[model samples]
Target: MKAAALLFIICVHLVSGGSHSLQYFYTGVTRGINFPEFTDVGLVDGEQFVYYDSNTRRYVPKVDWIKNNIEPEYWTRVTQIAQGHEANFKANVGIAMQRFNQSGGIHTFQSMYGCEWDDETGATDGYEQYGYDGADFISLDLKSTSYVAPVPQAVITKQKKDGVAAEFMKNYLTQICVDWLKKYVQYGKSSLERKVPPQVSLLQTDPSSPVVCHATGFYPDKVMISWQKDGQDLHEDVDVGETLSNHDGTFQKRAELKVTPVERKKNQFTCLVEHKSGDPIHMILTEEKIRTNSAGNNLPVIIAGLVVAALVLIAVVVMVVKRRSGIHTAHDET
Candidate 1:
């Protein structure tokens, strides 16, 4: 939250592989914010593939494989669909602002659509969620085949725009999204499947601050980062972070352990990073190895640390539709 505006937890898209995932993210912002009116990003297996923004007005591939392999017609179709969604999203944001009786501030309307597929078993499932001003706006209930809004303001939308969004999402997640995901996996097989070892480091801003285990440049987005004290796994006072993508499509993660000088001297602390790309890296926590810096803002928490407890995967928090608002607010699907 930032000064009367909802500061979104700007997430780098998370996708899956093997067992692959496809994620489509769309964001529409209030006018006068100078941000893009609409932006869309698509990711497969945690790698960003495509991007589109109001300025470009065209769907562009973010990766070489996607650019070289995908047909122009596919891009054209995606652009057209995204254009339509942009129009509707902008309008919806405006209407929503009016309904909320809001004025003179930057507001955002965001949507995340994700799909998960297990290649071996062909098992497929996914989730679709939307948010307004940092709060869960709406979500889908595949079992009942209806839309649900956890918030009071969105209830009107749930009633009037019920099955249409759910049906489209269901079809998209099962058919269109999954089909594209398979192609993405096929196109980027070499890079997606390749393993790269992580560069591990021990960091600390000051002795009073927590000891940080920073792992960088790992591939496949799957890696284990943990701390060991005296040859035993140490779980307490540790703040382990989720994996995040680097600009080059590699992944990085960190875990923090709080300790005092006395504890550090008495115990042998080691940071371990295990990745499929290579052997596990062990960095023993020694005074000489712990790099100290005063800059805490260097590592910013860009995305929400939302964890999903489900058979599928991580999902954005969902809101229930409050009572119906008389007028049906049309939320467009991208």
Candidate 2:
């Protein structure tokens, strides 16, 4: 269950597309506590399809396509490889603990490797990087084809390894990984290529709050949100937040623009949203157009109230007709 939750967080770091990707993440913890000492996950196009852990000691498929389409031997080979990586990561974490002169606190060593392919342009890219205690430690520089260690603590380990691993990584990322990505994409093409458009809203809390342009429920995870003033684009004072995943596999993003009423009155303000699912959207920021969370400003409640009033009016009309028909029948009888 934790592995499934991690997939959503990993979406923010992926190379998104019309393209496809194959990524593997491994982590080793200093102390197991309630969690596994070592864990591994594999994702294609931001969706987790396979998972492994020190406790499980097995490579297991998370989706139907793998069980239906992939051979059993693939899991065996992957499990063996992950076991080897688990041992190395554990030892590396201990060594790091010693080097840092820490005796008992929890620490982590993490590694991520992946390849991305642009189906539209036939372009490709690959990456391999490692982190220690949640900060950059070492990475294979694809451009220089050498390892980079950002801090002094990692320099010793960086000096021990040569260019052999980098060369291997280059080959795997460019050729082997991309081939696997294409296959996985084919296996799930029905879902991998489908598009769902975004639902966009412009929101404000009060007269002094920043105006927010929120877009949610978009698929493919690629979008552009920006602010425009009059006929020109406003590049400054706009805070663009990270793209986040929804529980149902869609994506959302927010861009906030801080503007004074004087500035808003002098120029036309607009939020422009672009996504692959549909045509671009331009929402002009007028005071009357922005949805608010102030007292008595809930849109849903307002709409519901209108619906209730209409229903009450219809019920009254029906009752009046019934009463009038009964009176007419009595008078005719008399």
Candidate 3:
């Protein structure tokens, strides 16, 4: 029993100290730091204007709303503001890394300053977060800002001595979040409840094969994509994909089903999409339906082709008649 107890204590000691050794092993080599060089901020009424610098290459006008509505003068001012913010953020990050003695491989640092006011609740909240190497090292909320535990003891000690936590909260609230809110409120009170329905498409690499249903351009992010057979949900042979963000701040996802020949013949398979938008969208699966939709989309092209052919035939007939009439006139004159 005494030997067992000694073994258990030794295990505990190793487990406790082993984690620190592992962390040091992983971050032993010093790597240069690279911070984000751009800023993106926006406001929304019924319309949203998400402004970012075009030079930053992070902003792509994939949504028609941004492409059509962004004013040139507004873009100019936003670009300048983004540049300034980037400079200030990088400078602060540099100072923090130096303070932490970060001479190690690939450490990431992040800072977010946000403010929101709710008209219904009459609550105004501001938040700030500082993360190092993807862990929340310090945080600032509406009430207080403090260093989180589980960080390096050296870091915690330095932060406490320098009063960094309190200063960060003050500067972020007064200098950053407040200023952003003042500008954002002017755009209007556009709640995030607005839902933009996804644009869905069904794809099959081969005829009479497995079907893939793709959904894109949805907003607010909560959505359900399913494969159904004869009004019943399917489990087996169904592969549900993850929802990912689009460049324009929208979301997209896909679901695939490997269907049997018998199910394909019955024409009862469908891809159902559920979103915050009212009713579910149904995309029927069958070769006949695919051909019908294809034909309907091609109707305009078919009509245009027929019209062009008829015009060419008429032109040729007119030219032949004119040539014959000229030959007859020449023959009579001769």
TM-score of each: 0.83, 0.72, 0.46
Best TM-score among the predictions, by candidate number:
1
Per-residue lDDT of model 1, residues 31-93, tens digit only:
776567877777778777788788888988888988888778877777776676678777767
lDDT of 3: 0.44
lDDT of 3 by residue, 1-334 (tens): 1111111110000111101000000000112423223334332221224534324633333344444545666555544544554444445444446656854344333333334444444344544344444444444334444433345622543355234445554455444444444434433224334578988777655555566787777765567999888889988899986554454555667787898667688758888999876589998886654422334444344224333322111100000001111001000000
- Candidate 3: where is the Cα deviation over 4 Å? 1-84, 91-108, 115-126, 132-137, 141-145, 157-195, 203-212, 219-222, 226-250, 254-270, 284-334
Query: How does residue 86 of candidate 1 score in lDDT?
Result: 75
Which TM-score value belongs to model 3?
0.46
All models: lDDT? Answer: 0.69, 0.67, 0.44
lDDT of 2 by residue, 139-175 (tens): 7678887778787776765565435545655667788
Task: Quote the lDDT for 219 in model 3.
Answer: 68
lDDT of 3 at 167: 54
